[model samples]
Target: MELAKRIQPTMTRQEQEQRDRKAASNRQLTALLGKIAIYVVTTTLAIIFIAPWAWMVSASFQPIGDIFDWPPSWIPENFTLNNYTRFFEEANIGRLVLNSTLVAGSVVIAQLFLNSLAAYTFAKRRFPGRNLLFVIMLGALMIPGQVNLIPAYLILQHVPLAGGNDILGNGGHGWLDSYAGLIVPSLSSIYGIFLLRQYMKSIPDDLIDAAKIDGAGHFRIYWQIVLPLCGPALAAMSIFTFTYHWNDFFWPLILITSESLRTLQLGLALFVVRNRTVWDIVMAGSVIATLPILVIFLLFQRYFIRGISLTGMRG
Candidate 1:
């Protein structure tokens, strides 16, 4: 009887140990399955988004005859440079690229300076109606840009002593068909101000105070200290501003009528319309148009990500 009692206790301990091992194995299995599921979902999403661009790139190289073949080959059977060569041959690519670069660059630089300045004031300065004004500005974002489009155009059209307009703000085309018209309306963005304001709020007030103590004026402090510290945010804004203006179509189409001042997007649209039947060449143009955006993103990606991550941390 004594031996049986001792044996029973030993059996119970062994059974408990077995149960614990089984439970641990089950947990590990469940965790592995969860990881696999997450990977599968992520990979599927990546492929879905990347497939269209991959196909477009492939189609850009395929011969014109092979572009619409059955089964939709991802790899071209007949690779040719004819489409790209023909694209340059038929379009004023250099002029279009130059116009796009100029417009986008101007907008990016102007937005960075103007928006950051406004953002600094909103963030660091104390003034009456500051919050109210900020809220009003943010409210503008909720309003559809289309709602303000006509008003903006009219304002630009009637500027006194500019673009052949009289003091009464009516006489000629005003800003219509001019670079000033294309650029001025986009010089400052409410969204940009909001973004930079949020980011700037993360900056310590001690720095600004110290700069003032050292006899630095607001602009001097902003130009020397604040601007350098806001590199990440500035990079983010530059990428955003450049991309938007570079790919802009509707605004430019409505604002510009002169062929000489036409942007890349405008030229691309005309190219598409003119070569509706030649899809391969169209794809080549698209590829070229997309390159600048890719380059800009690649150059600023690290800063952009850091800026976005830190933007709302304090505010």
Candidate 2:
């Protein structure tokens, strides 16, 4: 009887151990399956997102015939750099690139300065009719750029002070087809001002107070204190402005009639005129045009994220 009692207790302990091991195994299996499912879903989404860019890169290297082949070859049997070569050599792509760089660069600089200055005033300064002025500026954001296009063009055409327009606004040398015409009008972006103002408002009042106590003027406080803290917002605005101006097609197409003055987007459109579309060349040019943006994003991606985070905090 004693032996049987001891044996029963040992058997029970073994059984309990077995049960615990089984439970642990089941839990591990369940966790592994969940991880695998998550990985599969994430990989699928990544592939879907990357597929178009992959196809673009592949098509850019494909031979002229393979580009429009019936089956749509994803992998080219004969890859060549002829498209790129032709782009640089025959198409005067360098000049188009220069035009894009100059226009985008100038717009970025001008918008940054103007928008930041305006935002500082809106955020920090106590001026007469300030709220009314800000409301008017905000209202401008609601007006579509297209609606103002004609009026803006007319204004540029009759710019009174510069461009040789007399006070009477007659027979003046209009800024049509000029870089200044393309740039100056775009400089006053209400969205940029609003974004910067939102960011500026989030900054602690103590910092500005300290600067003021130190005998700093509005300009010093702005340039030294506010602007440094606004790096992320400024970067975000810079990216937005640069990309918008760089990819601007309609406005440039309307304002710039001279081929030499044509931006890259406009110049690329000239490649496909009246039903003659060279798909390979067009895609190649698109790839080229896309490179700058890609480079910019990669370089400023950290700043961009920081900007977004700061903007969200303000909101």
Candidate 3:
């Protein structure tokens, strides 16, 4: 009887251990299945988003006829460089690229400087009505940009002492059809200021105080200390600013008239011949127009992601 008792207890212990092992294995399997599901969903989403761009790139290489083939070939049937060569030959691509580069670069630099300065003041300096001002600025974001277009046009068009305007701002196309028109209005972006402000708020106040103790002026501290630390945020703002201004069609269409002043987006519109659309030329131009932004984004992607995340964490 004692022998049987001992044997029964041993068997029970073995069964319990087996059950524990089975439970662990089941948990591991469930976790693995969940991971696979997540990967599958993400991969599907990536493909869906990337397919259009892939088609665009593929079509850019194919002949116009192949681009419109019944089945819509993803791969080029007759690969040719005619589209690109024709685009470069027909369009003053060099001038368009220069104009766009000039405008976008100017806007990025100005916004970085002006917005960061305003952001630093709003973030660190204590003054009355600061919060109210910031609220007003944020509120401006809610207002559609189109709503301000007319007002901006009127203001720029009649600016006193600009573009041959008299004291009353009523003369020779104040800022119309000029680089000034394109670059000036975009000098300070409210969204850029807000982004930089949020990021700057995360910086320790103690650093600013230390700089002051050493007799560093506000400008010195802002330039030497705060600006360096805000590199990621600035990088993000630059990319956004550059991309927006570079691709902006409506504003330039309204503001610019001279062929010399036409931006890349405006130049692309030229591809739309009177009634018919030149799909091949459009594709080629799009590929060209997209390259700079793509390069810029790829280079600053790390900073852009980090800036967006950290800026939101504190504010």
Candidate 4:
């Protein structure tokens, strides 16, 4: 009886401890499972986002025949540079690239300078009707570019005094189908000005006052002090401006008629001119056109990220 009682008590205590340990293990297991689920969900989302780009890269290398084969392949079985070669040789794609680069570069430079200046004035300077002017500028953002396309085209076509036209909006060659037509309308971007203005407002007033006290003129303060500190915002605006101009199709399609003056985006459209389209060549041209932007982003990725983050901070 003594042996039985002693053994039973010890067994009961051991069983209880074992049960507690198992409960603790179960709690740990639950936490681990939650973390694993979160990780899986995150990875799945990343794959979804990356899959399209991966497909594009794969498609660019794929042979024409294999592109539409049963059960789409992720990897190109027979990779060839023939598409790229054909694009460059047949389409004069190099010239198209040059045109895009020139237009995008000019837009970026002009927009950055003008927008930054306007933004600085709105943010720091005291002037009559400043608030009212800013409100008006903000309101311009609501005006769709499509709504003004017809009027803008007409104005360009009838621009007086410069294109050898009289003030009556007639008898001039008109800027239509020219580089000037392509660029002039986009010179002053209201959104760029607004973005820069918001960013500039975050700067402390004391810095401007101190700079002014040090005999810095308005232009000097803007050029020397303000511009340097606005690297993030400027970088962001540059990327946006560059990308927009580079990829712009509708405006160039409407304005530029000459094959030689065609931008990269417009040049790519020429592939579909025939009743039957060459998917391989078309995709190849697309790949080429997209590469430059990708390269640019990769090269300036740090600035792009900084710009985005900086802009978000103010918002």
Give all candidates' CA lDDT scores: 0.87, 0.85, 0.87, 0.84
Query: Per-residue lDDT tens digits of candidate 3, residues 1-315?
Result: 346446667567667677668878999999999999999999999999999998878888888888888889998889988889888887789989999999999999999999999999999998999999999988888998889999999988998888899999987789988899999999999889989998898899999999999999999999999999998889989988899999989988999888888888888886555315567867888898888988988888897777667556645
Q: Per the 3 Å backbone cut-off, how many clashing residue pairs does candidate 2 have?
A: 0
* Per-residue lDDT over 147-230 for candidate 2, one digit per residue giving the tens place of the 0 to 100 score: 988898898888765567787665765787889888888876887888899889989999999999999999999999999999
Position 263, candidate 3: lDDT: 87
**Off by more than 4 A, model 2:** 1-27, 161-167, 309-315
What is the lDDT for 161 in model 2? 59
Native-to-model Cα distance after best TM-score fit, residue 233 in candidate 4, in Å: 0.9
Ranking by lDDT: 3, 1, 2, 4
Q: Is candidate 1 or 2 superior in TM-score?
A: 1
Which candidate ranks first by TM-score, i.e. highest?
1
Tens-place lDDT per residue, model 4, 245-290, is: 9999999999888888899999888666751457767778888889
TM-score for each model: 0.89, 0.86, 0.88, 0.88
In candidate 4, stretches whose alpha carbon ends up further than 4 angstroms from where it belongs are: 1-20, 161-168, 273-276, 309-315
Off by over 4 Å in 3: 1-25, 273-275, 310-315
lDDT of 1 by residue, 1-315 (tens): 346446667567667677668878999999999999999999999999999999999999999778989889999899898999998888878888998999899999899999999998999889999999999988777898789899988987898888888998899788888888888889999878877888788899999999999999998888898889888788888888888999999988998888878888998898788778889999999999999999878887887677666544534
Give candidate 4's error at residue 23 in angstroms. Answer: 4.2
Against the hidden true structure, what lDDT does model 2 obtain? 0.85
Error of 3 at 173 (Å): 1.9
